[model samples]
Target chain A: MPGYPPAALLLEDSMKTALRKKLLRDMLFARRFEEQCYQDYQVRKIGGFLHLYPGQEACAHGVMAAARPGEDYVITGYRDHVHALVCGVPAKEVMAELYGKATGSSGGFGGSMHIFDASKHFMGGYALVGGPFPLAAGLAKALKMQGRDEIAICFLGDAANNQGTFHETLNMASVWELPVLFICENNLYGIGTSIERSTAELDQYKRVAAYRIPAAQADGQDIEVVHEAAQIAVNHVREKGTPYFLELKTYRFRGHSMSDGGAYRSKEEVEEWRKKDPLEILLARMIEDGEITREEYDAWDEEILSEIEDEIVPFAENSPDPDPADLTRYVLVEDDPYVHGGPSKGGA
Target chain B: MPVMNIIQAVNSALDGALAADEDVFVFGEDVGRFGGVFRATDGLQAKHGENRVFDTPLSEAGIIGTAIGMAIYGLKPVPEIQFSDFIYPAFDQIVNEMAKFRYRSGGQYPCGVTVRTPFGGGIRGGHYHSQSPEAYFAHTAGLKVVVPSDPYTAKGLLLTAIDDPDPVIFLEPKRIYRAARAEVPEEPYRLPFAAAVDREGEHVSIITYGAVLHEAREAADLLAENDISAEIIDVRSLVPLDEETILASVRKTGRVVIVHEAARTCGYGAELAALIAEKALMHLEAPILRVTGYDTPFPYTLEQQYLPDALKIFEACETTVDF
Candidate 1:
């Protein structure tokens, strides 16, 4: 921001101001939302597993910022509230989803890890690492068939790099020239184990080039850096009808999940990463660019904090739970209209 | 109507599906150009072009996962896993992703792909190529597990599997791929996802599906030779478990002998036996008998011994009727 980055230069001053504010606010909203989720988890308001997306906000917000929502497909592993939020799924509904309320994106059927809104083109909250790779390829295949330039963004974890699907889907995506961006969120650690202990080759995108697909990595802590990388990946796949792999080098501020004791990593290492926190970096950049003063940054933080506290949480809490009868819904349907959960038959 | 083997009928059914719906396409290992290992999708790539029918990398997970993505994008993708034994690579996709898509989406998305895989023993494919894994798919809730006994049913059931608005695991008995023959209609005719009694009797009901049905028939013949009437119940569809038709047959027979080529432990035959014990136990003339493969893994050389043969089924039927 200090030296007029190329991405900012491509946009008008007003457009740049609007986008920068949007990116910062988007990242802040995600941070505040996940923080609220953490609080809710502590109070037992959020049940099951809770994976927060605080430090890696740039990966979600930046990639989604480069996306054409409602046209492109966005899929991610379990740490996915931010993906759903960035893709325009109602923040209140996402909160409701975590609360297991029927008003959630997946109607409470998908709690914490599984959130899908077809209307928003937010594909799914695949809880399995490397689970969404093939699906992302298929989504990109569908876009290719429909003659659309929209790409599918698949957010896989660093741990997922060793999965057979990681290699299988990447190979297929390359062979078929599918329009998918396999964004590996290399947050240094997978759950508790560091990447060095997990994957043999630490540079994931390098191995991805085995399939001959163009691959690169970005500083996922910097919003502008991530945005630039994602834009290149998105534009390349959208235009070339091929796949691109981007490894976002970032760190998770919190444990892999709520249950982790943070005993796996060192205090010094955590402190070092926290120093380059994406939110703080973006805030510093915005302040340095004269887009916002420190006072305005603090004020924006307050607004986002209140937005989640006063608005989203209450909506999620007040949301209804699903009926017992809807349990067998969406199994199979007749071809006439493609419906789900047919008339009740005598139970065996 | 033309007489064809299970492989031809399967190919015809795929061709029909491709012609019926432009959105329908078939992809798998050796499915295109080579027309599949068994030629089940034979001449399909040539007829339908490389796009509609194509070969895939020898990655079952990739094939199934790609089909899922295509299915979600409004396409009827029929992905073959080459052999059911080889489907383990794609198990995560089939079980975790495809099977759970619709229910997890709360009716927003339906995993409408038909996973056609050749399964069952007697092909001498050892552990890697020959195995009956229908129980694995049947045990899964959201998947439709169909094991056809003949060509007509194979074609019709494949058609139905493709048409069903959910994922289907079409387990073709590789043992009877070319062994079984029937006059499948040239034009596509939908088959009901219900059991059909190939041969009906009253004393001992030999319930089976896939390749084991042949053994069941031989056992029925053995019973006929002994002046015993055996009602052979072919379990056409495994998942929905046509308990009504099966129980009706069991009620008439008063005794049951379940037969399968899968391992005795947790095999589909156990489920069938449990179903009879649960719903129609009062009508049981004897403790229901299971003529099944050994608990050990399918052996390469000892397959003939490992798989349940006609003699084993016949002996079981005789024991059931005598008891």
Candidate 2:
């Protein structure tokens, strides 16, 4: 696998053909995987809240492409399947987690919202709106305390900025000079509420100025733009050893969750955002640049779809459910006395 | 052994934790430089360096949230909330994130965060300053709720909490921070999360924790004078409750009186009462009574009246024994 290329390599002129192809493939796989999830949810294969990452693929793929997987810590909100995949968590494991199987990433305990792969440094996918803010800061604090060069990357929506923790954590991150990149995937609407209707200041990057942290905004529809901006943001945090905020202007194709029909959005609005689809933008860009033919792109898409069907779906379907007898296993550490039973016979 | 108050003992425990483990971090509001408002972290920053012992912004959520992160990254973070009453701002971090980390992650990340905070009423600090919120934490699963009654238990239990593999809510009885003193071990030692038989007896069993244990001791002394022979059980750890110790005492006494500084409606006392009623009801000869703070908000001038004192505990014990 091609590790995250340096910021200097991500420039439009210097970008490698292979790296560009890999970015397209990764985002294509994510898009297809999420579409599979939508189908699985409809067919009752996957249970619980399923947050699909379709139109906003570039945000996760682009930023993560600039991050060192299995080294740099990454955390995000509930829409996390693609993020976990970008961090090197196996697509099968993520699918298994959605299937609530024992072989899942979190042993089926986390379901859709809490995909975690500590081995890959994918911290987690938190369900709470603003819960990951302080946690991301904490991760960066740990990295700084240990004298490590790795930075913590936190992903959230435009609406999460309204949370008290968002303000509190950002202020603390700046105050402590922690190495963290706060990426706001500004999909315009947090669920049904548009950014204009919700936030007073529409520009999420401007809000970071309050904390005195350096920030930039980029078009999240284009993987090249997203990757270029993320590389700069990542480099800023990594080199300066200070927090940086990067707002990606993007849109999600689906609703907040599987249950949401997105009645709050107009068809014209959805169609308009769909026109700037992140996957199509990258694929079309590569084709226009004479990097690949239409037939090759179609062939790769088919391969990714087949892999999701033949491997990911079957693995999750065949995996066993978590045993009921071991229900309280992870409440504490395995060796903890309380895990086996309550208090001992007499007073300590 | 050296004689120290709860504050001194807590300080020593934190000092020992930082000295022993390079990964141990102590931080909170006014903890560094100021050495904490109550001086529990007194002189710690000077001794252990600013990085290990530091103060944080006054955001409780930020403090606990960052601590949770540090713990997830394999550091032992013992963060203070200044006062337990102020811990509500961090309730989401504590209840949802920290408590559920290990379980939700399928044991991949065990958040070993020992959140130290001063709790209980007394010393004239009204509503915000002195509220025993142990019940709130005790109700939360995946968290160990521990209360240190005096100096020795304070140091020992705190060390154990810091060393524990899971998240621990170490609620320090601020009421007895300076008032209660004892000869504590100089070296670091761990105390188990189980009740201690403070005073063993027969007629009546007094179940209590935190600063309220002192009142139970005084009540036991009063019962001794009246030849009641009250067995006092100091429930140091409320979550991993010492059920055997409590049940054994209740079985021997055949009468029980639960006590706590928190309000009575659904206090930790109610859990104890329910436990006794469910498991050891046949051994009981009388109805279990509870001597706890009233079901109202903690009052300022009426703090004395609101708190369950020795007289109240003694009365409750008398009622249980007489019944």
Candidate 3:
């Protein structure tokens, strides 16, 4: 573990106490959200490919924590529930979207793969691998053109690091000095395939240095460490108005999704990572600093469960199935002017 | 008024549009400094600087996708694809994102962008460079497609495209870039979509657009020598096909010929031919004639035979006359 950074020691005193508590709360929320999605999938409540952001919670939390809400934009791939929630899309709507209800974000038309909230500055949950890279560059160009001191954060998996769009977008962004942060969430695997087996470059952060853009690596599991690294990258993007890259070294606790069995990696390897789980690390730090007593932690757990039971479960249950007639609604704006339900006309 | 070729008309129109509005910007390969391969953007980059008139990396997808983002950010981006054949790489963005943005987001997002690409095949540049992709875009909803035949209409329609509410796919005829010249207006004006009617004869209606329009006119002249007076109808707008003008011409002529350089199957001509059959069946004195490229892929060796020329138009017209 000498090569690996320590969780509690890696944090600043202020970040360790306050930020650690906040991260713990957010991570628990994300875990519960993923658990609910699994239950929903079993009962036939959710359909289509549902990629849970369970193990990748720290990257989302830390990156969003560093960005100013409504100023910066966040664009990520389909494994994006935590990214959306962390960027401030309401939990109920995120749940409803997966349930394919009229009240869901994108009016249930986008479902899990294409959740978008322009108001919250979560640009989209683009399904195409590396599609968001060029899109994020365009957004950064727009922001720069408007003279706004804002950076667009583009998140992709380590597997997407080899995609040509990533290189093209990064080169263009660097050349134009566009304000963007290209964060590669290296979960060590693309589905069941290991990074080393797929790509020649294990040190993905060095790829961005070729474009002369500033780059860094972070322990994506530790929220405090990620937050510090993100803050540095975000500041560089803001001050220099240039693209920055952060290679987030992380791991997935789940087997890609509900479909995959735990056949690819050994149970011992899973157990090893589970011991250094992001949630447990933050919870331990919060308890050690006396931020929350055991009683408080227990009460918070009860509160989250009840909130899920009363709000999420019922919302999923009572939410109307999308009207069959409205299937063609979000596909294109019709003569009647298609209006998505439960939100303002702005699709927030 | 000054007489100008298709290229000059386009260049003046773009310059005028840029001057008329501060938001209009041009970006594409060789569009800046090099002044575009067809010289459609000649001297504009020098006048507008690199910001307003610039060159993008040689990715058609990037040119279009970035233009969509720019349009969403409230800039009137008139992106150019170097050639019509090369526009396929960006087809997904155009058909999926740009065309559907206004409708998909429930009008929350409207991409008011224009794409200007040179299409059609009289030139010797085989498969990759010579293609008329107007029908592909016309098949898509939420897109206003235009292909002007002459200098005057090209200037007016280009301006209208730059100022239109939705995204416009302006397909310029590369084969006739400087082949024909006509007087173009110095002042800015818009020739409304579905509003190009030529009054020549009551014998036969020759309907066409883009490069084939000139050929249609020549065929009409040749028909006139044989005492066959043919009316020429220029379908300046493909998507919103000038139904009123087309129908009126059909009503008078009682015979029709639809000509286009795209393939014989599922081309823009098919739609016009179908419309005439549906709306003006009773008015027809003869069968509808369609002069178009063969169904096969555009070949390199038989390039001249592949293109629809004056002879093809005359042959189709002769059949209509015989009927």
TM-score of each: 0.54, 0.55, 0.52
lDDT for model 1 comes to 0.81
| C-alpha RMSD by candidate, in order | 18.8, 19.1, 19.5
What CAPRI class is candidate 2?
A: incorrect
TM-score of 3: 0.52
Chain B TM-score, candidates in order: 0.98, 0.99, 0.97
In model 1, the clashing pairs are B201-B231
Best by lDDT: 2
Q: After superposition, how far is residue B195 of candidate 2 from its true place, in Å?
A: 33
What TM-score would chain B of candidate 2 score versus the native chain B? 0.99
Query: Which candidate would rank higher by TM-score, 1 or 2?
Result: 2
Instruction: Put down candidate 1 lDDT per residue, A137-177, tens digits, no spaces.
Output: 89989989899878898998877776687888989998998
When 2 and 3 are scored with lDDT, the better candidate is 2
Model 3 segments more than 4 A misplaced: A1-13, A331-348, B1-323
Give me the runs in candidate 2 sitting further than 4 Å from their true place: A1-14, A339-348, B1-323
Q: By DockQ thresholds, what CAPRI class is model 3?
A: incorrect
Tell me the RMSD of model 1 versus the true structure.
18.8
